[model samples]
Target chain A: MASFIDFRNPPGSDRRADNAVRATAEPRWVRRTLIGIVLGFFALFLFLPLAVVFQGALAKGSGVLIQAFTDHDILHSVQMTLVVALIAVPANTAFGIAAAWAVTRYRFTGRALLMALIDLPLWVSPVIGGLIYVLLYGRRGYFGPWLSAHDIRIIFALPGMVMATTFVTFPFVARSLIPLMQAQGVEEEEAALTLGAGGFQILRRITLPKIRWGLFYGVILCNARAMGEFGAVSVVSAKISGKTNTMPLEIERLYNDYLFPQAFAVAAALALLALLTLVLKTLTEFENARQLEASRRVTLETTIEPPSAA
Target chain B: MAHKKHVLPGFGISLGWSVTWVSLLVILPLAALAGKTAAGGWHHFWETVTDPEVVATYRVSFGISLIAALINGIFGFLAAWIFVRYEFPGRRLLEAATDLPFALPTAVAGIALTALYSPNEWIGKWLEPHGIKVAFAPLGVLIAMIFIGFPFVVRAVQPVIADLSADVEEAAACLGASRWQTIRRVILPPLLPAILTGVIMSYGRAVGEYGSIVFISGNIPFQTEITPLMIVQKLEQYDYTGAAALGFTMLAASLVIVLIGNRLQAWGNRFRKHA
Candidate 1:
């Protein structure tokens, strides 16, 4: 996520470079016009929808918005969304760290294949991500009859929803962490081990601090996706009112029922969450840039060794 | 760089966990779908995929998605160029806004887009007078896809554009090339792979997208119906095998797109090296 931003010029050089380009770049009128068009494009496509979410939510006044939020079904959906995130985020974070550690720290056979397998979820559609679960656990599924005999409802239940969300978000933490971890390498941990620190000690005292931001960024992404997951959850949820309906599903139900204000109210809430996620993403990215600059400066001053061969 | 040795202690534990978790959560379920898809034998699979209605759904899904991706590719490039090359008030805010599609829930996007483009809505009402129906039409599918896919293109291309050095452009200018010539000759070639990647990702995402497109498309069978929606309808009817067949088709298509993208990117890299 941090690497998504390309601050090609060092921090100190950006201003001077911007000035240099501004002096000799395209005409002011042309530049202004282009900028206006770009901004307008964003305003229409991005900002306008965002505004509509709120406008529609507030259409019936603040009282309706409150009533919508206070609706029992909507409240249950919110709780369900939180519950899903609470379970999924930590699970994925652990998996991400483990996968990143294994892939980055060791050289082995089929390593490329393992990384590719991790990326499989990224290519799989969210709809299919849900559908696969149905294929595995729905009434007609291979394990369906058995699970039903045992009275364990995996599909059309919370477990099914959690599984679908987990599957859909499986790659976020790992994807974000792998590159950062690969670049980090295992040298620091190796150094700590050489100094007689135990495995857990090195991980806790050295590695955790270094990779905490990446982990947090990945967790945020995972959490956002998990909480907002719709297509996949929709398939397995069976839309059993408050029982299986997540917030997004609730919003969809409301909209489909012509409960426009209620739908937009919930959407506004989700949109706020999205905005918060974006804010966190920006902060993490900025902090990552700062850290990268600091580390580079440190390396230049020492000039004795690089951290990792890669 | 070549892979290096490490002294990590939990390699076995971590690797084992990764394989087990991924296999259980993702691999096994997908394999089950694939297995079920083939359960009816190759002939059944062929007939399902070749069904004319299914075929038309595929065409509509991929066709509109491709167009949307292409639109994103062009506009996204321009947007990336603006973000990377210019300094202006609210630039950071607007640049951040590009990622709204990524963060916003697909359902929210679908509804917002539906409202914005419905004949009774603001933008839709204005366009309605011109016979350009958006909501409940195939055009609505394109707009929904564009709304959802715009970020992939912008995100893919922005870094490359930003990483580009000003010195190269200045050198091109000093060599008596016009700005357009400089961009065409020096800028675009390297950016092509990124653009292609973005387009492929956008296409793949749009193809599989359901939550957002479900509302906007109006789900008129054989007209505005999409593959994912068709699959859901199958699921609703308890047609597990049928749904799996459609889902498997989508999966195969995505895999092929990914493979092609990888090959093209590799080819691009080789060409760069040779040059």
Candidate 2:
């Protein structure tokens, strides 16, 4: 029942473990030399192919690169991507704040199931998410007959893209908010309620301030995921180039057609976006991971407040 | 901050809210798929689901995912081990770089891997000389899966390894146990649970993975086609029923895998406690 080996004892085969360390430690002076070697591997593995595509795009020189940015099709796709993220992220954040408040603050039937359901999108491929919409709203889909009777254009349309993106990205906001709410607990909410503040007032005055940073964090991630979403968008979009293509789908199209340069330019842009979002996520993740820290902050606030009145 | 003298139960409201979201987010989409498949009637649905090419594609995807997950599990663990046990120069950089897969778009990852390992490229050229066809082959699918899946295992195992106190390993050595024996008997047992968690997570991710695989897979029907890819293909054909049917099937299979993987994780945790 106890640990198989206690840490109280010295490490076994000190000589061998040390030897192992030494063996790996070789090229320490050569480490910087190998920095390129390792980064070369990563660059070769991660960046080079993208670079190759970018280079191919640049084959026509700076003119093509400029042309890529100004191209109507590329511009439309870029604009559409920004529009979706801008719209979806804030809407999702509002939804998430409410959902996180409800789920964490209240114990209800099917709570666990809801938690599981929220994670479903992360598990299901985005492609499936896309197809689900088509099955539901496409011409002959489940509700397709009814919706079509109403002249509703659900598939191969912008609205459809937005809806699918929303569904696929439905999890992030709530997920990000849940841990924060869970960590913060309801002491503050209770305090506000006792002060005669209504639910909405308490939420605005107390809850929002506590979790504004977390909400912002969630929004950033939701935006990143929304912007980069490919399989689902690719599936639903008509591949109408300038009309429907997001950056990801555009990259896929160019790569598929061996238009490496244009493809990589977009891919490079995506990589840059991914890098930016990653930095943001890291900052939020640091904030999120400190479960105790949030609680400690809450505790500190309460400690500084007046003791409960008679 | 609101301090409640007494708060009324808000179960109904929260429950209603949760059901609304779940219905909209998860159940509705899937139900529509199932409904569509069922609308075709069982006979037609059976025929569609059993299409030989469709079945073959499913097999290729499943088989390649298994292969890729296994490969990643092995190297992923070793990479985790090297990163955990050995602290040399550039350690933090390497550790940070391990998360590159998380940052890299799957599509970008696919192209990068394909370019690097394709038969014509510098690395792929050597691989081709060895008659190992990558890019646009099943092998390429495995490579992408491995690339994307590596981070899961490494990330999962790293924290657990860090939490392991050096005292236990020292105790094993004090018993005159060899380093290998200590690692196998003492270290490996506890690590198995975390390792299994990583493996299952990676497997699930690999199974659902699309962006990364599509590029390298060449999307060859009946060859390198993945389940998710197949769903997309079906949707492309306007075979809404078939796509939903396949999606439901994959959903069920993955759900089962996840449940079983969870049980294994629980069992592993029990072992760690008992160990």
Candidate 3:
């Protein structure tokens, strides 16, 4: 994620040198018009809706916002969302780390296939994510009869929500780490191993430290999506008021019931969560850029010798 | 590569864990959907997915997604180019804002969009006198798709734009090429692939989008309903086979799109290398 839209100029590319080539640049009016159009698009589509979330939330005043939060059902929904995130994030993080290691650190057959499979969830719709679970656990599902006989509930329960959330967020950590790890190469881990460090030691001291920023970026993204997941969870949650509804589901319920202020207020809270995710994501990206620069400098200093003047 | 020995000790363990985890969480559930759909005979599956109402959703979903993706392709290119080439006040802020759609929950986006365009809200009120309806209409569905699919193109093309050195344009200019000529002959050639990939990606996402569209579109059957909503509606009616059939159809469509996307990306890389 951080690797995709790196805003900085790439190393060895000097913008100052490029700026000297003014003859190739667009005219003042052309450049200004493009910028204006882009900014206008952003203002109308992106910023306006975001502003409306808060404005609608505060339409009746902060007191209404506070009262909305204090509602019993809303509070329960918040707790349900947190609980789901707590379970899903760690589970997916562990899986992501393992998957990234296997895919990046070793040569293997079907490696490309494995990567595509890991990325499968991203291509699948979130609603399908939940629907699959229901097909496997609902009353008429494959194991539904046996599970019912044993008195175990999966769908319309916490476990179902967690599975749906986990499925949707499955790719974030591994996808983030894969490119970074591939770029870093396996030589460092090999070197650590040759020095008599054990497997865990090498991973703990070298690979983990090397990929921490990417890891954090992945976890942040996964956590945000997990907490805010709606479509998949909604499919399985059955929208039981105080029992199964997550924050996003609760917002939908309130909005559908014409409780506009409450719906917007709940949305405002999630919006804050989204804002926090952006801040953390930006910070991780900055750290990742710094790390890349440092590594590039190290490789340049050590690996490349300056040519002697002929 | 296969002959080389791995220095890592836990390759087997890591690979095993990865396969097991993915199998349990993703593959097994998907197989269940497949098995359920397969259990229903070909006739049943065909009838479920090809029902008139379901077919209308496909039209709405695919039609609107294509339009939205086309719109994003143009604006997303401009945004990516502006981010890479120009620096202005609030530029960084806007760059961050571009990602808000990705981070913000689709449900929140859905409601916020609904509020903003509900005929009495700020933006909606202005358009109301013109008799232009957005909310509860197919146009509203288009808006939701556009909002959710906006970032794909920008993110896809930004790096490609940055990687394109200004030296190429400078050389073209030195050869007496006009600005438009240089852009058409040199710039747009390589970007065509990236832009296509981006558009296809956005289209894929928009086709499967559920949360954002459900609110704004009001889920009116045969009018503004989407495919995913149809699947949910089937599930609610205890039409498990029907839901599975729709899901299977979408899954197959998305798979085909993914394959196409991969081919385009590879072709794009090859073009860039040779150029």
Candidate 4:
């Protein structure tokens, strides 16, 4: 990879002795200044706000924090968020797997278009994500008359919340899985078929195991966004206390009502969820790196030694 | 190529499921936005989108988003450089923390920022005497935009910088080229495309951002209000067509940015292959 940028040096050219000169290096002071600036930026923008959440949450006392948690409205919002995630995450996971399989396995027209469409939600504003649903399902919307005629409610209801969450999180699983599956390729599946394995057997025994870490990574990301989503869900939720509010909306409600401690307490809980997500993400990334390294070593060995020797 | 066959089973089922889900969940709703906008008639759509207050939001949203992306382009590039080229204490932890904005709930971030930057708060108290108001101001909107977009540039440029060889700079030095000259002529040329892609992506994310900006900006129309906020306000008023019109404009702008980013990325790949 580095060789491609080595315009003056041909491939495999020796230049190790020149490394002692440190010609390409910045001065010690320059390096320190650069690092200091970057660190300060992170401290100011990222770390400070994170610290403020916990500080504000505990400003009154731990007692108030506990009280806030036990509040019926806050508890209901937590339950509502859980219910939404329960409906959305699995739905997206299944869709992601199917989309990944379809995209990575087959050669077809519109493959690029399909992948782009899968990613469409990420680019669109969360507001637009909700607004589109409102256009289709609100009381005066496209299907509004039909839905009302049947006495069915979609907007400001559980189904609309789930849809908004699903829309925002739709791409995470498939996006993570596609690159991993494409890299692993069809050779393993072909070999399995040659051994008389059925489709489900191959999927369960081979494909699933191979992509398990990626799948977990994707699912974790999907779950984090599903639970934390604000804009899209807020648009459709109507913010009716105990009925439509999720955790983020609940925080907004508390903050707007001048319940600062309670708002931050709720936010701190969500912050903890975000922290847990980061930890799980880092673990999966570590596992992914190890898996890739092990596979690369296996490939190196197989290429070096004849297959018949095995 | 079109006739290529796959040995894998369930292709049809998988494709069918994916197509059906994408259509129902993603495409159809987006189409509804378009259809609704069209049904309102072009003249009404134009009037809503071009209304003075709505135009003010476009200025605030696009202007601040551009500024935030530019800031990220500079600072994010530096951060990426340090992470890739240097080893330091807590570097790994800091790198992981960069993704906090992406993972943390935006509403949480919004309030957290408000808490920190409000006049009575830690950072804000210091600046308040200097007449710099952050919360409930355009600066607050800018900060929120910057926070959400911080990760894009760093993530984009890190791999490219890592892949860049130190030997090229060494060679430039061997030829008696100055450090700045080598950086300008050799280093930045290859990195330009990645930086552009990152900046554009950040800009796109910032433009559509709603959650974080709502609290910090105070949603004062024609002041700190963003376009997405305008859409939501329109929806709240039951002005469905107006909301749809704004939504359509935003979606079109994002799609164009994405297409351009893709083009730049492809061009970058081609340049690398030739090099």
Candidate 5:
């Protein structure tokens, strides 16, 4: 408790003493009003709508909610969403780590361009992301005739859905990993190499452990997006009830059918998933902060020691 | 020269895989879209893009996006200020809540917002008596834009606020500057760049937003209709050329915004260094 207070209000410092005074200096009514305004803004804009989703879902009954989930078509949509996410997340994880490794571990030409290319998906509209697949593989598209000649389906099918999800989520894991790995530098891996470790051995024993938290966070984000993706997946999906519709698409379909309870119930399920992602996100943020502090300390010590030795 | 080589092995393999994967997934698809547009000839593309309905979408999308981003800029900054400055109950929860929009599916956000703002719904029921229509109106589109774009501003500004030392503020206070003057002359100058970047990014995102706005906007042509929705409508109608043209236009606009934002951010960094 003493150490904790010291951390918050460090001793023997003018700045800390100033902060201690400022913390309580704000007028009480002013603080209360500000808090009320912020709370009201969040409550109306965010919390109320989230509450409405649950309230609407359960307005009918628990039995109807169960039926909604078990319906043949909705079940298929849920499964399809799972399958796409399952495929996309792991693939992007590999791509992310590889990209992070390349860019951070080596000095290469076009590295900046590669970084910008990874961020391209962020700029492109999700609808355009889906449309790109259609332009490539739709019946009227460039590869359409060739694909049809071979009796292979791409667009408006499962493969196309997977492709679009991958495109939209391409940057997530890579974006997360790049900063972490770049901060770690290549010194540790070089040390392991000098110790006669093989490449796979070095990666497993040295690199992977260092990046595990970042990798985990990336997968969490990538999976959330893969499961939640609507626009790109919708464009590529044929929207056939049991065949191609993902969870988000099915929610729209059910709502359009005026099946309000069922629609919100499924949305409630996704809301739970979003909540889960939030929990994982907050935990990873804590871990990442700790890791950053540790790494910064190590870098500081190394820099100082090297200078003194020289 | 020899020391310039990477210490680790398999640089070639990793780089090869990353470039190949990105090319096949991201670069190729975008190229395909652009290629298809080019193959259709410039006249047809121009005609599709400049169609009056398409032009109306341009106006509605960019106009609402700009207005919504501006609102978010102010409110998001205020919210960030509350988070940074105050030690209140539920502060952590509210901070996490700010990320709700980002974590929630856009589709889910759309329907939920619609449900709340529909004429007979909770808030909407109260507003309807006063002659305000939120759901299925242009107002609803603006709301969705604000919902999705709020996080960009908060996340962008929070770090800068946190990095700012309180000692500086105290120094200004000791120098006999009034609170308002200190905020204007000492505080706002450094924060202006971050706020601008946040607003620009939020605008870019709002302009491209589709899934959330789709359920709320009522999809009315010449009113709530947005460019992305129109592109989807064209796709549904099997007008791939029209869809491509619309998508291309949005993509080009977003790219220009991002490029300009990057330049501005670099300039901001330089300004900070000089300051």
Candidate 6:
């Protein structure tokens, strides 16, 4: 109990008394000093490596880094990355919202197994996912002949690359949106139906506003992962240098050829963007909590159970 | 998602849509790998998977991933602790830095780390006489794995750490417990589940990671080569059957890891319920 008061009443207050007795009397200082050393350890273990990468990236002048951005291959990579993210993220978002709604709004059989199957890609290695696409659509893939007969090129091509990315990253938004929708309570929608709000109107007016933050969070995550994907992209894309190479593939090529500065600089930009997304993620929750809580209270107020009059 | 998707008849419809998409796009390809591997017949498939190069790559990949995940587990915990417990200059920046591995293309992360730690580089020069090389070696693979893997642990543990009531620890201190004792008895026990969960996830991610590791790992067979690299090599050989064989082998191992992960998660959920 005495230790309790000393520990919690304040910090750095009574520690001096322990210090006075510490000379020749205790190695408690050693243990406490070890706690102080934790900071140094954190810097070495976590921050130092990251700092090294950052330093390597910035060692080249901004002009050089920016110039790398316009080099035709780098630009092609960037353009392809953005093009894919632009297309894939929105597609996933729409899929996510529709899927989130379905999962949360309805009750039916086979739902349990279906949820597991949806989560399958998350468990499947990205490399394996690429191989799977190859298997399904490659020259000897099950449908390869069918696809080729139609003059459809899905492997070693842009369409193939995009399809691979889309499959691997599909679940990000739906997983994010489903829980938020579930918690918002289904009763309000029931009330909306009683008032003849119609399905689409209820969604636009009610659900979209409520789940927007979650959706935003999901979309940002989806975009980041989509932009950064490598293994799946590597497998299916043929990595045709200027044509199919994205930032990640470009990084590998540059490094393979020993172009260190340029590669790090490009990577640094993507890392910076990802870091920004996480910061947004932290901000999102507080904003989401406040919005959801406010609307939830509103929902409860209108929950009069249809006012049964005998 | 704010409004109920009231139009759908049941959860089955959405689940069906999601499953069908992930299945056709994700699973069917994998199933094709299986089909192709089968095409090679058992003897040839076994030979392809167990080829010295292929097995060596898996050994290096698994070995480095295990080491990196362990290292990241320790530091990732500390980073999470700092993010949750401390307020300091650049705290938010550090928190954001942890996500670098996730956002930055793995290719970039691999390259940046390689440049920084390459033998002739700034930090490496200091350790060169002592003979530590960071780039284009097995160690570089470990370094890259650490970079791309830490975010999983940090992000997984951060929220749970934040939601942990500080009062519980305070109460332990209010008793006669030493700070260490309080942390062990009061703090670490609840944290173990989350930490373990994070560790398992990061381990799984590192096991499968290809891009970040590829640039730094030198891709030297019997040294820094990884399983994914082996798969790529097979494709390069125009030995599609061999590539399919190797890919299926790794796919099987990853599924085992995934199943183990699911079991760990289920156990954690049960423990949470009991707690």
For the second chain of model 6, what is the TM-score against the true structure's chain B? 0.90
* Candidate maximizing lDDT: 4
Q: What is the fnat of candidate 6?
A: 0.45
lDDT score of residue B101 within candidate 2: 73
Candidate that would win on TM-score:
4
TM-score of each: 0.93, 0.86, 0.95, 0.96, 0.94, 0.86
Error of 5 at A16 (Å): 18
Candidate 3 lDDT, tens digit per residue, B1-275? 34778768889888999999888987898899999999887999999988999999998889999999999999999999889877678888988888898999999999999988999988899999999999999999999999999999998898888778666776787788887898899999999999988888888889889999999998888999999998898889878888999999999998988888888889888887876
Q: Report how far off residue B95 is in candidate 3 (Å).
A: 1.0
Note the residue pairs that clash in candidate 1: none
Fnat per candidate:
0.66, 0.35, 0.69, 0.78, 0.59, 0.45
The segments of candidate 4 whose C-alpha lies over 4 angstroms from its true place after superposition are A1-22, A300-310
> Where is the poorest 10-residue window by lDDT in model 3 chain B?
B1-10
Error of 5 at A250 (Å): 0.4
Each candidate's number of clashing pairs is 0, 23, 0, 0, 0, 4
The candidates' DockQ values read 0.56, 0.40, 0.60, 0.64, 0.56, 0.42
* lDDT per residue (tens digit) for residues B131-179 in model 5: 9999999999999999989888888788877666565666776777766
TM-score of chain B of each: 0.93, 0.88, 0.97, 0.97, 0.96, 0.90
> Each candidate: RMSD to true structure?
4.5, 5.1, 4.5, 3.5, 3.7, 5.0
Task: Kindly report the root-mean-square deviation of model 2 from the true structure over all alpha carbons.
Answer: 5.1
Q: Which pairs of residues collide in model 5?
A: none
Query: lDDT tens digits, residues A146-184, model 5?
Result: 999999999999999999999999899999999999888
Candidate 4 per-residue lDDT, tens place, A175-269, comes to: 99998888776777888999999888888898999999999999999999999999999999989878899999999999999999999999999
Which candidate order results from sorting by TM-score in descending order?
Answer: 4, 3, 5, 1, 6, 2
Off by over 4 Å in 1: A1-24, A299-310, B1-6, B267-275
Question: Candidate 2 chain A — worst ten consecutive residues by lDDT sum?
Answer: A1-10
